[model samples]
Target: MSLLTHSRQRTAPSNTPPSRGGGRRTGRRAGAARKQFTAWLFLVPTLLVFGLFAWWPIVRSLLLGFQRTNLVDPAVWVGLDNFRALLDDPLLGTAVGNTLLFVGLGILIGFPAPLVLAAVVTTVRRGAGIYRFLVYLPVVIPPVVAILLWKWFYDPGSGLFNNALGLIGLGPFSWLESPDTAMLSLVLEATWAGMGGAVLIYLAAMAGIPAELYEAAEVDGAGIRRRIRHVMLPQLRSVIGLLLLVQLIGTIQVFTEPYVFTGGGPENATLTVLLLIFRYAFQDGEYGQAAALSFLMVLALALLSAVYLRATRSWSRS
Candidate 1:
């Protein structure tokens, strides 16, 4: 009887149910929910700030784009009349063209500069930090200071640029005087001032690249040029594309430099789209036209952003 009882006890399973595992899982889910709620609570203030300050203003401006208003009277519905006038305005066309030119020239001059500087820094064996600091120095300077310095440098008769050109027997060129050179001078100044940020970004990107890749390339008898072409360039393609898009958008809205330096003078050679919008709204008191122009600028930027997003999506898929 004792042997039979022992055998029966051995055959029976443990009393604890399998559902305990499910209970543990439920507990974990509850804990996760609590953490998530806490995180959201922390994010609420940031979201509220963005909504109130950034999003609300954007919404108001978009609504204002459709209405006509001034300091004295309340806004009235204008429908598409403002848009029609904007399209018909000869000055608008000129502003658009000049804005496009500024963006293009700025990118052409500015984009590669930082990349080159970053590449050089990466290759240097010594004093790289000093070089970076020197390059970044101008970026931290106030815009007013930078613009004033460039203005002094570009002075036709007594500027440093003219002096340097004279050493090589070149003419005392009127940089800001002529319409052709005015925009170019702006491009040069912008490039000089803006290259530091690009350099920093590119340097960071380069630092993220694995050293093993370069070491392997070196072991395979690859030279610097070959490695740059096959490895570095391919890795930087996405970064370069992103930077190009950002630069295009920023350059299109350029105002401060041109406003301070050129005042949209010399036959409006340096007048950007934003400057024209400002002149309309404040100087001329043409709020309708200004709103219309602002809306058009927004449309252009949206289109550019859309195209860039599509290209980025396609690249990611590939």
Candidate 2:
């Protein structure tokens, strides 16, 4: 009987305690779950605040595009009327053209100025920090304050520019008064104000470029111009491309200069897309139209970014 019972004990399944390792693994998994839950608990407030302020506003704006309301009154659903009205308005065309002109001017003048400045600064061994500080000084100034300072500098009568030009018998020209010069004046001030950031970015990018590439180019009989063309430009391509896109987007949405400097005057010469949107909402109380216009601008910007990225993908990869 004892022999038979021993055989049965060996053959039959017996209830065994879970291995210590299995218990430890379960405890570890529970601990990890608790840690993850704690992390999410900490993130909840930030997510709530972001949703309340940022995401809610975006969603509300999208809804507002389809409704007509002065924000005090009841919102009336208007469907596509707001969008249609935008297309019908003559001012839209003018605003678009002006925006395009600003962008073009920015590309031609503003885009290259910082690059040139950075390149020149890179060659200087002494007082380089002072030059950088001076270049970046305008950026630290408040936008309105900087614009105001430039306004004084651009004063038609006894202005700094005119006074300097008078010595050479050149220009006591209307810097911001005439339509022909008003947009250009805005561009000049904008470029000066914005170039600081771009210069710093370019300087940082230049610093990352290996000195060996330049040395190799020089070894291959590449002079200054050739070295820059074959060595520097190729290396900085990605940074240059990114900054170009950012500048393009910022210039398209320009408002402050035209608003403060000219108030879209000199026969609406400097009116930009953002300024026009402002006029619609605040001036005309056309909130729906403004929202519609804003929605369209968002779409256009998104499309532009997508297209630009798609087009530049190959260049970036290569």
Candidate 3:
């Protein structure tokens, strides 16, 4: 009996309670519960709004995309008829082609303009703030005002563009009248209006880059071109990728500029995907087709975003 008692005393822990491990586990569970409650509390408003506005509407649109309705009668399920009709429509092809062209041209001209402007501004020692403000001014202008201003500027007889060309002995070209020039004119306007945002973003990104990198390059006997190529370009890769993706997504769905300026006229030269969707839904009362087109556009944007995200994964890892 004595030996057994001594063995028991030796095996028992002194510093901890018999239920200490279980108590610690229980405390951890309580803490986790509190954290979960706080998370839910923080998420309540966003979840409520998303469920009410975003998810509900998305589900309803999906259902409507497969049905036929005329604003009064019950929606009749028509299966894939709307999609089939859309596939067969000639204007669908035209809209797609025009949208791709518009996005391509917009990217060609608009994407690089901001980077160049930012670089130029960074190189300026005097009046940099004034130049930045002037460049950013158009971004704050109302879309209608900007479009009207461009319209006035593109006027064949009394426009600044025509006057400049005339000084070089060129004839006053009809900007919005000809199909060949109408889309180009719209693209030019979009480039001018949208460039400000890009410039600001690039400028911020460039400012984040350490000045020591340039100084180090100079110490190595590097000239301006070499410094920019080795120091600036590599540092700006992620920013350039992000801006390119954003520009591509936004330009693909361009509506206001073309709608207010050309009205998709001169043989539908300026008709974009969003404009086509607007015409179908509001003008032709084809909500189902318009919904389908909207869905396709969303899918395209998702794919582009995914590609860019993958390309910039290195930035996140770094």
Top candidate, metric lDDT: 2
lDDT of 1 by residue, 29-113 (tens): 9999999999999999999999999989777776667788884799888888778878888888888888889988988788888
Residue-level error in angstroms, candidate 2, position 249: 1.1
Residue-wise lDDT of candidate 3 within 1-318, one digit each (tens)?
699999999998798648778999999999999999999999999999989998998877777678777556887888998889889989888888888998888888888888888989999899999999999999999989999999999999999999999999996999998988888899899989879988988899989999999999999999988987999888998788778888888888899987899888879888888999899888998888887778778888999899879878887455
CA-RMSD of model 1: 5.9
Sort the predicted structures by lDDT, highest score first: 2, 3, 1
Candidate 2 structure quality by residue, lDDT tens digits, 228-301: 88888888889889999999999999999999999998899998899999999999999999989998999999
Per-model TM-score, in order, reads 0.86, 0.95, 0.89
Instruction: Give the lDDT of residue 244 in candidate 3.
Output: 83
Local distance difference test scores for all models: 0.87, 0.94, 0.87
2 versus 3: better lDDT goes to: 2
- A best-first ranking of the candidates according to their TM-score comes to 2, 3, 1
